[model samples]
Target: MNKSTYKNQIKIITNKNQKEIRIDKFLKNYIQNISRNQIQKWTTSGKILVNKNIVKKNYKIKPLDFVEIEISIPSVLDHLEYKNITAEKINLDILYEDEDVLVVNKPAGMVVHPGFGNETGTLIHGIKYHLTNSNLNNFNLYRCGLVHRLDKDTSGLLVFAKNEYSQKHLFQQFYSRTIQRKYIALIWGNLIEEKGTITGFIGRDPKNRKKMTILKQENQEFNKGKFSVTHYKVLERFKYLTYVSCNIKTGKTHQIRAHFKHLGHPLFHDSIYGGNRIFMKKKCSNQNIEFLNTCLKILQRQALHAISLSFIHPRNGKCHFLCPIPEDFKTVLENCRNMFLQ
Candidate 1:
């Protein structure tokens, strides 16, 4: 048993007598707490290395091969986090619900799930209470039926599966990119093209793990990140801002936000991406600046919303959902229109 553990890392060396086996399968057997899906994701993200070289999840272990895994506590013990989450009676803005699926309009400012500082009053907590009160106790509570997530400040459609079968089915659809999702955002600058597609690999910013960045080329670490494509068309144009509808081709973390930022047009009021600041002209009027500030004050977070989502149901054949932009988002847009059109 040549295995050792260090700070947030696991090291294992296959002995001469060890037989060949797929890395993911081997890791699942050896590590009791982790999942095979997480192993595969870590392998793809260059977090798992064999002989100090990144390899695919299926790479068979050779005798004397060295394996190193960089483990993050949050991701590795997500199940524990879910279990620790207490179900609070938070009201949910449910758009649709059935025996197998629950689609909700997750409001902006609400955390999708419990995390470091956001352990209570999350969407998952609300859902848990809803399910318990509804008397649907048999459903899996490990993740509270959550199949996907939305950013804390990005409002919109999110779907949860009620059973294991539906969860697996929906997971496959999301993994295969068969799920259709569209977002509408008010971004910082006017777009040069009315419609365009931004294609790049999205990875965590090396300097800032809190944010995602568009990788210019396939590097050792960036190669582990998923390739993303965002298709955008101008919905409306304001004086210095643009309203756009974006159809995402890939569901990478912060795909739309990072992609547009890579193009120098971050979503308006996205403080994390530098959209909260003013992009000004030398002769900009005081009225314009004051108006922009008012608008910003109206919408304190990123002006991005998942406007629509469509997917083939595991049981019902086809399902499509659309979420109207939240009040703050709507009001901000209206203010922009009045100011710009004048």
Candidate 2:
């Protein structure tokens, strides 16, 4: 294998011991941060060649074959289907910005990236529009430098890398669990302890593919789920609900919601995990039920907010950010105090 000093192109020569393989699949394995589909696209565009000849994506290479791939630094947007994601004039609450990174306070109910139902008006679309028209726009930016993400309904501070170097650095910190992240949540029922940790293996539910659940003891041995841990502390207690702060040791899909639900205290208004309805504690008066219903009306989504985030910058030193709870979350807590504490 020979790579140019600037990494603008890559040339690979198959050895005698090398087995025949499809060019697209081989390149996908050889390249970093590139997908097979992107390789196919490059092949179609005559960017990838075999023996100095244009080839199809399905072309198989035998031993002693010579392959070359052109690296398009400025054309990185094509890999993300940038044209398909329309940039919109959306308001972005930027907390911090530098040559290497951009931190923004993402609001609740806003999708981070485009998906099936959410094709436009996403955070990425807004970021594209914001950067493309600004001086910060650069050729090395990939996927708007998104390293991590929050659920659509969860509001929090999110950091974006402005270049590939910063993106990989941030990703390493998150994977190593060195990044400190804390979330505040309102959950149904009171806790027996002031602080505790929930440990379990979490995976997708077989019956409901859209939802995640903690695997039972029998399924855990089979490695059907990823090990997850959530440490929580009671911040305030109501008659039938508890305000808590959660520090997750492992970042997984729906980890906080699934762990709390497994602990018999699902997050309040978490409809999927069964915390939306009124959870009766002993005999409740009709007035109390009505009051609980009012709180639910105030907070329609799960009561979860990423309050604190801290991490070491790739180029700079340590960076920390804090985002206060949204209005709906605050209103629900105030109403809980007024009715239960009073």
Best TM-score among the predictions, by candidate number: 1
TM-score for each of the candidates:
0.76, 0.75
- Per residue, candidate 2 scores C-alpha lDDT tens digits across 1-342 of 121111256677877876787887666545445567888999999998889999988999889988887765432233355556677999999888887888888998999989999988899899888877677546443443676778888888888877666765666666456788899999998899999999766778877878888887576332446667789999999978999999987778898988998889998989898999887645668888888888899899999998888999988889899977899999999998988888
Q: Which residue runs of candidate 1 sit more than 4 Å off their true CA positions?
A: 1-81, 136-144, 218-220, 281-283
Instruction: Please report the TM-score between candidate 2 and the true structure.
Output: 0.75
- Lowest-sum lDDT 10-residue window in model 2: 1-10
Best lDDT among the predictions, by candidate number:
1
What stretches of model 2 exceed 4 Å from their correct place? 1-83, 137-139, 220-222
CA shift at 314, candidate 2, in angstroms?
Answer: 1.6
lDDT score of residue 78 within candidate 1: 36
Please give the CA lDDT of all the candidate structures.
0.80, 0.79
Candidate 1, residue 54: the lDDT equals: 93
